[model samples]
Target: MGSTIFTPFSQKELIPKEEKLEIYRRERKLCIGIPKEISIDENRLCLTPDAVQVLVNAGHRVIMERGAGEGSFFTDLQYSEAGAEILENRKDVFAQSLIIKINPPTLEEIEWLQPNAYLISALQINLCSKEYFKKLSDKKINAIAFEYIMDEYKQFSLVRLIGEIAGTISILYASEILAQTNGQMLGGITGVRPTEVVVLGAGIIGEYATKAAIGLGASVKVFDNSIFKLRRLHTIVDNRVPTSIIDPKELKKSLRRADVVIGALPRINQLPIITEDMVSTMKKSSVIIDLTVDSGKCVETSELTTLSNPTVIKNGIVHCGIPNLTSKMSRTTTKAISNFFLSYLLEIDQEGGFENQLVKCQEMKQSLYMYKGRLTKCTIADKFGMQYHDINLLIF
Candidate 1:
């Protein structure tokens, strides 16, 4: 029979067999926005003038609102010289293709953003409300929380840098506070014994706090719930500082003798490690700098305060719980943030912009809470009782 006598599946050879490849997207020229921080305490700028110069040199336009860098002491002239366009109206900055900020945008600022604008900023979840997430989602913004963004090492790079600054600043701040409160020095003298510093938690903040305190010639001890963290810290500090697994009794005992307490623990909704009673047990006129207060109060007595009115006296102990405490050195923090951000934004550009970045970079998805009006972060979804969408499913 002539069945199957057809010539090699009929016109199969006529069909073009060239292997199809993905359409290569050229690098994007992202327009970056830098708005003036609305809140006074949010003194850090996302990009320094040098970063602006880098982005501009890479064929991108930078738009900064007038006085955006005043807090960081980076003048508009500097940005202008760096090839940034200074806009008189702040809303104009938010209208750009990309927005990089130290603080999350205010509701008004969010509304000002063009739909689908890429936002890179701190989430500061504790400070956000359900409505805040809703506003971002409603805007259909592509937002990434810089706080949760991880580096190649799977570490929160931005948070660690800021934490490092916060830790060192915590000790320095305590020194000034101690002198004012009781005329006591922070470090040891030749004859006098070394001043005591009690550091809570053993994360990046706690570790840096320990190092700074030790450097200042203070007798130091660290306490944390995790034995692993404590042990790691012990090794990191060369055992110069004693480490404990947060024995309540021992903590209370140490607090009594502690001249400075640096609360570096990452506490959220959970009850603080140091209760009010524990704080009360500390010596009078002792200084407590709660570095983690932005997330939650590490010391029960510590209340979130502004930079202008930073310290509060309660139980005869001076407490400072200023969020963005590292912003006290606005210039330094700005520079560090700028360095991190310069690389991050350029990577996004090299990847062909944010959407392509989402498709390719898993680490970027880790920090994304919202994508095109969908809730992508489980933590934010759970907190707000909103529907959670896995970013992976939505993107790919």
Candidate 2:
């Protein structure tokens, strides 16, 4: 009765209310490392001198191992002039907070990495063994594949760019190989029949390959398992190119008359679309360029080869399965890669810090294959027979 008679307490006094707001963290300066690629066929560099300059201007430290940019034709002096420290010992470079390179680090290179360092590189899963993942996990490193990195639009930006380059380069390489193999031209001449190019798959690589082949006056035909992709490719190419479903019989017939066959199919299963028998039926001395060799080739005869020893003659056909075809234009690819990395790193820095960015950025989350010591990608885990953990669980 006395309590009921007392005056009611104010809401502030009852609840002890206090104003609170989210904290905005200060931007962090990163220490980025660029190591020289030891892989003979890897010619592209992840970051350019101009990109280093931009990072340096933002107060980040960039460490370049001596000759890190040599493959891409960017001199050490260029990187130095742009405010990067050129270290003689590569291990010292790997000690940086982040390491960015064109190729994934070898086991020896991984040994030099500091614990929990951020690794940005291509995860050529075809080349990696289970032991590779174990080593990276043991080090508790965070690995993000540039190839797997998605943009705001959900498109794989670097992968598509590289595919575009590889597509064009595939046709160019076919032209050279055709001339050297049998002295045949790639395009049609006046009053002469046009060279026929059969492109497998209707992805980015296939579309660009068709464009390049068509531009050179070659009649191009595309085949894909997906009718939507075939239609998309037809529309993308202005509906000028012929498209077909991947009918084994039709493909065999086309290959028999094809002057150049470009395999651009994404890996569906473990096997190639074109059997050895199919390859045998192709015109003698014609070229086959498999742009998807990194994933798994679409041509049975194609083997992964380096740039130095690219083409292999088999079944009287020139088979070129050099996966990193864009590496031939190292400087252009380096610039393109650098453009992506500069923007990405800048965004990370602007977001305050790596952990802060991780908390707020979906793109970075999508890019990371590993977080801390756990495998965050199901594909990698399945490939290696390792347990998978969702990256969201690891971070948040």
Candidate 3:
């Protein structure tokens, strides 16, 4: 009774005032670095001159390795005009807090990173190993893979753009190969049979390849294991192209007569659609562009080749398995990639900073494959036999 009498009115019984937290918006000044790519046949640049200008205008420091953008036809004067400091020594560029590039850093490049630095580049998962993760972990670096970067719609924006470029280039390269083999054009000619183009996989690359092939007046047939993707491709191509399930008999029959065979199959599957025996049946001098070769060959006889020596004759078929076809059109690809990255960097400024943005943006969080050197992507971790940590747990 004495305690009850001494107790004041409980705050829970009364209407309590709402406690408001103060929100501070401070400009995040980041030292962003662009390193020259030394990987085999990588020509794409992460940012363009215009992108550098925008970042510089936002009060962020931009450091570029001398000649970093030369592969994409961007001059040092252009980047300098956009307010970037050009450093001749690569180690100086790598000293920046944020590193961006096209290919995943080589082990030597990773050694150049400072502790807690952020790395943005392609993951190249098939080329990655446990040692890669261990190296990044040892250095306590954060890594983001462009392939995992997503948009508001949960679609892979970078992958789709690159796929479109690859698809268009694939058909064009095939046409060149066809001309090299026999002095024949890819499309229909009066009284001449149109080039028979058989495309495997009806995904993004296959869709664009079909469009390009059909536009050039080639007889195009697309095959996919997924009826949904095949149907989707049919609608995307205005219902004109022939679409079919990947029946072995029909596929082999097509292969025997096809002037160009495009292997645009998705990388999820490790098995090849066209085996050695099927490839051998193809017409001599036929061109096979296996765009999916990087992940795993879509044609059994196709081997990974560098841009310098991109084609090999296997069973009389010219197999071109260049992993990065987009690099052939480096300028256009660089512009597209720069646009994506500019928006991303601007968002970081608007959202306060990377850590805060990761907390607020689901898309940003999803794109982060590694945080503070810990493996955060389950698929990559599992594939490389490394321990996986939930990014959310590590972030907070």
Give all candidates' CA lDDT scores: 0.87, 0.88, 0.87
When sorted by lDDT, best at the front, the candidate numbers are 2, 3, 1
Report the lDDT of model 1 for residue 273. Answer: 85
Clash total of candidate 2: 0
Runs with alpha carbons beyond 4 Å of true place in candidate 1: 1-19
lDDT of 1 at 395: 81
Q: How close is candidate 3 to the true structure, as a TM-score?
A: 0.92
Candidate 1 vs candidate 3, TM-score winner: 1
Quick one: RMSD of model 1? 2.7
Choose 2 or 3, whichever is better by TM-score: 2
lDDT of 1 by residue, 1-396 (tens): 566544655487768898989964765689888899988677889889888899999999999999989999989899999999999988888899889888888888988989988888888888888988899888899888877799778999988888889888889989998998899998978999999999998999888888888888899989988988987887878655788888899999999999999988867777888999988888899998887777777788888888899899999989988888888899999999899989988888888887787778788888888888898888778777999998889987
The TM-score of predicted model 2 comes to: 0.94
lDDT for 217 (candidate 3): 90
lDDT, candidate 3, residue 248?
96
